[model samples]
Structures are given as structure tokens and as C-alpha cells.
Target: MQPDPRTNLNNELAQLLNNRIVEPDYKREITITFRVSSAEKTRLEQRCSGVVQSDYIRARLFDYPLPHPKLVIPEVNRQAIYELKKIGNNLNQQTRAINEAVKIGSQPLSSNVKEYLQTIKELAVLLEQTHASLSQPISDEE
Candidate 1:
């Protein structure tokens, strides 16, 4: 007995689809292929402007330009932390200045002080999180 057309279509649909693995190349040329309907392609293009069918297809298929990591020596991070600590005192002083300026109705000075204080707060939070992550102790429950 021959299988029904709908049954054959279901069997084909069940076939495993895997990506074509390739070597890592940030700027290397690549190709992509998909069996998308014309309507689907048009919808995608309309939603994301300046994206031609070919460009979208190529982007999906190939490795595109990716930035290389900036070289950061371990010592650089240490120096940065040290500098951050030194600047932390200045940030505190600026925060105080902001309060004084606000009292004097110096809106511009107050704004600058608020900006500096916010930056300092962000830096402090980041430093605290980094230190905590690095110095996590083993739990007694282990």
C-alpha cells in the first residue's frame, strides 16, 4: 500500500535539520540557505529596513566582521582598580559640593556634581561586585 501524500510530507518535515558547521572566521565569506516562502521573505524585509534579501541571506549564512578583544594585561586591571579607589575620594568630595551647590541654587554646578556622583556610584557598585565575585568563599554546607 502506498503512503498518502500528507503522510509523506509529515515524514520529510520530521527530518533533522542541522547547521553547516564551519571554521570560526570573523571576516570570512559565508553562505546561508533556507526554504522560506516569498511572503515570509517580504515580511522580514519590510520589518527591518535597508536589509535586502541577499544581505539578510548572507548574514544568516556567513561569519561577519566581529571586533577583536582589546589586549588587557592583568596588571592593567589592578592599576584601574587602584585609580578607581583614588578617584573615589574625589567623587565623595564632588558629591558634597553638589549638596552645597543645590543649597546655593547653582543649578549648573549641582547638575555637574550629580553627574560625577552618579558615575562614582556606578564605579563603586561595579568594583564591589567584581571583588565579591573574585573572593567568594566555600560554603560550610558543602
Candidate 2:
């Protein structure tokens, strides 16, 4: 007599929020695994009195219109200037870092560099695949 994992998790979350506890409806155990960052785990444990796991995700769905603050940025020549300034600032930071590393005689192409390049290449390939998949006309199965 084992409860489904989904049912057990839902019940546990309900109990936690209600400041109560309940054993799983079924006596048998089930194992479920997922990943969570340590910071998120700590935050949940601090806020909740009962079991919390990676499977639980909080979502906010708006079925009704909710008033939100509007940010109006008037488009003008200054807007483009600000964007270019931000980009220039970021590029400057990268340039400084690279120059400093070179001054220290760090290896131009270390294993870490190769691994990073490989990761970028893989990401580009993934992007191309994703683009191709999206470009193909989707057929609905009857």
C-alpha cells in the first residue's frame, strides 16, 4: 500500500503550510530525486515546517488583469547613446581583464580555455539545432 509520489508530495506540502504533519496515505516508501541549490534548500527549510524538495515549484498564474506599474522610456537619440555606453562599459571591463591576464603571462590557451571554447561551440551547435527545429513547419497529429 504505497501512495503515489505526486499525491504524497502534494499532501506533504499541504501539511507543511497548515502547520501539521501526516504520514503518507500508503505505508510503503518511494524514492524521488532532483537537484536543488544549497541556498534554495536553506531558504525553503527556514520558511517551511515540513518536507520540501526540488519537485515543488511555485508558480504564479494571472487569470485576471492585475495592475502593474508601467515604465515608459521615451525613445530618442539619448536612448541609443545609453545602450552604446552600457555596451562600451562591459567591453572595457573584459578588455581590462584580458590585458591584466596577459601581463601576468597566463597561458593563452590553457585547458580551461579549451574547455570554455568547446562549451561555446557546443552551445552554438545547440542553438543551430534549435533554430532548425523551430523553422520546420509543425504538423499536428490527428
**Structural similarity to truth (TM-score) of each candidate:** 0.29, 0.25
Candidate 2 lDDT tens digits, 1-142 = 8879999899999987675433324443666556779997787665433323221222112122223323233355346546555655665565567657756888585777557556655655665564444444333352
How would you encode candidate 1's per-residue C-alpha lDDT over 1-142 as one tens digit per residue? 9889998886776652343434555675767566879999778766434445564544555543333223333565666656666776676776687777778887565566667768878977876776555444434376
Return the clash pairs for model 2, or none: none
Count backbone clashes in candidate 1: 0
Candidate 1 off by > 4 Å: 1-80, 108-116, 131-142
| Candidate with the greatest TM-score versus the true structure | 1
TM-score of 1: 0.29
Best by lDDT: 1
Off by over 4 Å in 2: 1-107, 140-142
Q: What is the C-alpha lDDT of each candidate?
A: 0.61, 0.52
